[model samples]
Each structure stands twice: as structure tokens, then as C-alpha cells.
Target: MTENPGFLLTVLAFVLVIGPLVFVHELGHYIAGRIFGVKAETFSIGFGGTIAGWHDKRGTHWKLGWLPLGGYVRFAGDMGAASQPTAEWLALPPEERAKTFQAKPLWQRSIIVAAGAIVNFLFAILILGSFAYLEGVPRTPPVIAMVAEGSAADRAGMKEGDRILSISGRSIGDFEDIYRIVRFSPIEPMQIAIDRGGNRLSVDVTPGVLVERDRFGNEYRMGQLGIGKPPAVYDDIGLLEAPLVGAERTWGIVRLMVDTLGQVVTGRRSVKELGGPLKIAQVSGEAAMMGWESLIGFIALVSINLGFINLLPVPMLDGGHLFFYAIEAIRRKPVPVEAQEWAYRGGFALLVSLMLLVTFNDLTSFGLWQKLGGLIG
Candidate 1:
């Protein structure tokens, strides 16, 4: 496989992208545990059988696993990666129990559980901030340079040289803002405020549906106004302001994700739009080919996604642990072990089903079944 440069690059890119994110996630838990005087029994990158391992001076078994999907940090009382408490560890001597995760205070345990996702978000912020600080931020004015003939913008009486003031009552500061609003509102009527030659005017426009395909043959459907913007100007951002810019960008992505998920749930979007590891690998390879800046940007984007997904209130995830903690906090006691076990079991099954669905989508997107059928025929 190493001899095949393209194949090797793809594999390498996938590892490079996933490995650090997983490590950072686990590191967040490990660091939080250490801060609370909790003992980490093992810190492993990846899961299942160990490919290589060693014991650290702090009695932490550090290992690289054969499976490179995800990783975990097992505290003293944790029975598995999900951080379920073990009977033996719980029954240990008082002195030893004090150093176990389960023995920690409710607030401490909640922080420990939530640390992984928080760290992922922080990682993305740092990356994005650094990019903005170094390369400056792109600022494109919301001025229409062109309107497609007979398209939505043209039919709505939108003309070139018009400066967009707002959409749906929301202020528009940049051309990208217009794209963001219009992209999610295909065929939806919107009241757009514009300034034409210093004359304030309001126009009603319905965005047209636009379908696009990437080099990988993946399809994307979105709304378009069929309007063009002038060239963007790069504005140098201050060191302090860079992080704020990054945070805003991160929030924007989260909002988009939330909107997309809502659309999917409302049957406005197809479930086929969901992607899995295969899509990540493909995108990683493509980003790598586009140079370090693009690849690093993609990493930041993926990191935000990882953080967002982990923070979801689903069982067997970081958010799930926090959910249980929330319940424990309110009840003034932990939930029964049996109830937790059943919940975890259901969560596991749900996760597995989702994985299978996304994998099927990935395969279908790649036309794998069609190719196999052609061969069989």
C-alpha cells in the first residue's frame, strides 16, 4: 500500500486528522482526573487489542491500539472506555477509593466527564484563531456584482450594484452572510432590505434550489440567489481579536449543523446526506492535496464537529455521562446500576445502528453496489 502514493496519502491523512483529535479528547479526561487526584489506570489511543504499549512512571498504561477509530482514558474505577464504575474498584479501601473517579464529588465528576468535548472545542478555537492571526480574515462586502439572468435574484427585481442591508430582519455585514442565509432557505420567501443608489428599498425574493457535485461525485443541495459578490478584502486581525473571530466562526458552524439536523428531522433534507468515516477520509485526502492551510482548516472544522457530537445528550457519549451526572445532581444520588446498564445498552445499540446507516450511505455514494452488480451480471 505504501507503494501506491495516492492510497498512502489518503491513509496518512486520515490518521493524521483522527489521531490527534482522539488523543486530545482523551487527554482532556486524563488531565481533569489528575487535577481531582484521580488515578488514571490506562491511556490508550484507539480501542480493542493493543498494538504497542508501555507503562508510564505515574502507573498509567499508555498504548496504541490496532483500531484507529477512537481512544479512551480509563480512570482507576472505570470498567471500560465509557467510564462505567467497577465493583472491585468501588469496594477498594477508603484510601484507594479516594483516588478513584467514582469517589470524586458530583461536580468534579461532571467536569471530568465534560472535559473531553470542551477540550475539542478549545482545540478548534486555537487552530482557527491562529489561522486568522497569521493569514488575516476575509471580508467581502454584501454588494451585488452580478445577478443571473432569469434567475431568482433577477426575477425579484434585484439589480447589480445593490448593497444588501439585511435578510429576514437580520443584518448582513458580509457577502458570506447572504450565502449562509440563502443556502439554507431554498424556495423560501424572504424579505430582503437593500440600498440602491442610497435609496432604501425592500424586496421579496424566493431562493432557487441549486444542486452541486464535487470531484468525488458527492452531491450537495442548497438554495441559491444566483447573485455574485465583489472580490473579498483581507483584513488583518489583532491577536486578541483573532480568538473572538475564531469563536464566532465556530458558533456559525454549530448553528449550521443544528439547522441541517433540524431540516433532516423535519423531512426537508434527505438522510442520505449524512456521512461517516469514509467521507472524512475522502475530505481529509482532498484537503491535504490543497496544501497545509486547507488541511489545517479542515482539521479545525472536524474538531468542532467532534466537540459538537460528543456534547449531544446521547448515552455512551460524553454528553450521556453529563446527562447522568445531571440526574444524579438533581436526585442527590446516583442512578441505579441496573438502570444505567440498560440505558448504556440502548445507547450502544443506537450508536451501532447509526454507524451502519452512515456506512451504507457512504457505500452508496461511492457506487459500490452498482459496481458489484455490474461485475456479477
Candidate 2:
């Protein structure tokens, strides 16, 4: 069958977006390994059967593969890119063993493993900083624009043009700060400090609970104070100040992610919101079509999430490796190879399952499967 134009665009966009980001990620690991005197046997940009490969002066086999999904860097004496230990590697001579990743001191090995995520985070911060520097940083004051009629804000005596000074005993500097508080305090009655008609007054506003659905039908149960935004004002930040704002913005995104994850765990949020590669491809393609600025912002977001996700303690990931290293640090020795192998196996399986589930959701969201089913019927 002939490929669809839209499908081609998505595939191209996915590769363009994910390929360089992943390369940057693996490069972080590779650079760290080289710095610590570990010999990189292979520095691959993708997986599956290799399309073309060549050896560098240092004997690191650099290759591109058929799949543009992900990349890896295999160090000498390591079994593969994930840096799993091998029996043969363990049996190497002392000099050779010294060059293996497993042979490094705890701190060095830990740093090497954590470097990828750190780089991702830094990349995001830099991108965000650049965006803020180019476009003025938003400095929206906490002034009410419109309150939903008969909504929680209306019932609490909130009015148009009222400025929110604080919520739940915490002061608010930006409009987003107020939403941050109400979004998390789903069940609590908020003690709102408002500036109304040039007089400071306190009011109790209990946020209402509502279920919001995304385009993919992913549902979110959130606390809404029913306050809308006024016209935004931008603050022209200095070059030095932009990075600080970017860092703060990155932290805010991280906090929001953590809150969402917590809500998911507590059954207050639906797992449908959890997406995978296909969702990323769709979003990336859409963002790219919007504009370079939007695409860059989306890529920055993905980078942050990529870094955070890899830090998860599940096996077969950077975080998983660091977790084992933590155990080794405490025990004064590495975790047994056999135990690690099993853990990695389980982790890989779980990761695959999640990928499949999310891919299915993506297909469903795109209505591709339904169309295919129609043809079959």
C-alpha cells in the first residue's frame, strides 16, 4: 500500500525531533565515559540492523542503524549499551578490567550514568532560557479577569478586577502561582487573601472538582478555582535574569509532573494520560507545523520529561543503574550480576508492555485502527 502523506510527515518529524535529542543524550554518556578513561567500543545513533558503520581513531565503532527510535554507547568490556556486566568482562585481566565501566570507582560510575539525564535537563534549561531571552518573560499579575458564573470563585465573593494576593496562607506573585496552589489542594477550602476595591480582605474559597479531557480522551480530575486570566503583561528580563526564570519555569514543570504522577497513583487521575512514542510523534509533528518557536518549546518539554523519566528507579534505565549503584555504595560492593540480570529482564519486559499500551492508545487517538477495522469488516 502507498504511504499516506500525513503519515510520512509524522515519521519524518518524529525522526527529526527524537534523533538529535537522543544523540545528545548518548553523547553525554559517551563523553563522560571517555573522560574517565573507559574505552567506548561502539557509539551508535540508532538500533536494529546497522545501515553503515565506521571505527573512529580511538576504535569506537560509530554507526547509524535502520531504526531511528533510540541510540546507545557500548563501552569496552560491557555487554551492550545499557552497560550491563558480563561474565567475560568480569574475567578480564586487571588492566583491562580497570578500563571497564563496572571497574570505575562508585562516584565516577554513578556520575557517568547520571550524566545523560543531567545533560537533558541542562539542554532544556538552555532552550527555555533562549526562548525567554528572545521573547519577553510573561509577568502576569494575579488579577481576576472573569469568574465563572455561580462557580466557586463567584460564590466566594470574588469579582472581576480583584487581585489575588495569596491562597491557603501562601503568597502569590504570579497568576500561575495561584493556580498551582488550587490545582493541588483539591479537597481543601482555600483561605484567599484578595485586594478588592483598594481594601485587603480574606475570603474562604473551596475549589470545585471537575474532570477535564484532552484530545486523546485522557482524563484529568482537577481542582478548579474558576478564576480566569486578565490581559498578560510581559517583563523584559535581562540576559542574566532569563536563565534564572528559565530554571524556575523548568522546576515548575517538574512540580506539575510530580503532582500529576501522584494523582495518577492515588487513582484521582486516569492512566490514559500516560502516553508514549506515538503521542510524542503526533505532538512533535503538530508543533513543527505551528512554528519553529513552538517546536522548540515542545522539544524542551520532551527533553525535561526524557531526563526525568530516565531517572525513574525502574531497571534497564539510567535511574535503575544508579539505583543499583546506590545499593553498592551502601554494601561496599556491587549488586550480584545474576540479581541485576533478573531485575533488568523484568524491567525491560515492563517497559515493553507500557510502550505497547501507549502505542495502542496513540493509534486509537488517531483513529487509524478504527479505519483498519472498517476495511477488515
Tell me, by lDDT, which candidate is best.
Answer: 1
**Cα distance off (Å), candidate 1, residue 112:** 1.1
Candidates' TM-scores?
Answer: 0.90, 0.85
Q: What is the C-alpha lDDT of each candidate?
A: 0.87, 0.83
- Model 1: ten consecutive residues of lowest lDDT: 1-10
Return the lDDT, model 1, position 64.
Answer: 99
Give one digit per residue, the lDDT tens place, for model 1 in 1-377.
11222777888998999999999999999999999999999999998899999998989999999888899888888675455567787679999889998788989988998899889888998998999899888789999999999999999999999999999887888998898878987877889999999999999998999998765555677899999999988899999998898887788778878877877889877899899998888788878877889889999989989999998888899898888889988999887878887888999999999999999998988789999999999
> Highest TM-score among the candidates is held by which one?
1
CA RMSD (A), model 1: 3.1
Candidate 2 lDDT, 171-262, residue by residue in tens: 78988788776876566576999999899999998889878775434455678988899878887878998788788778877877887787
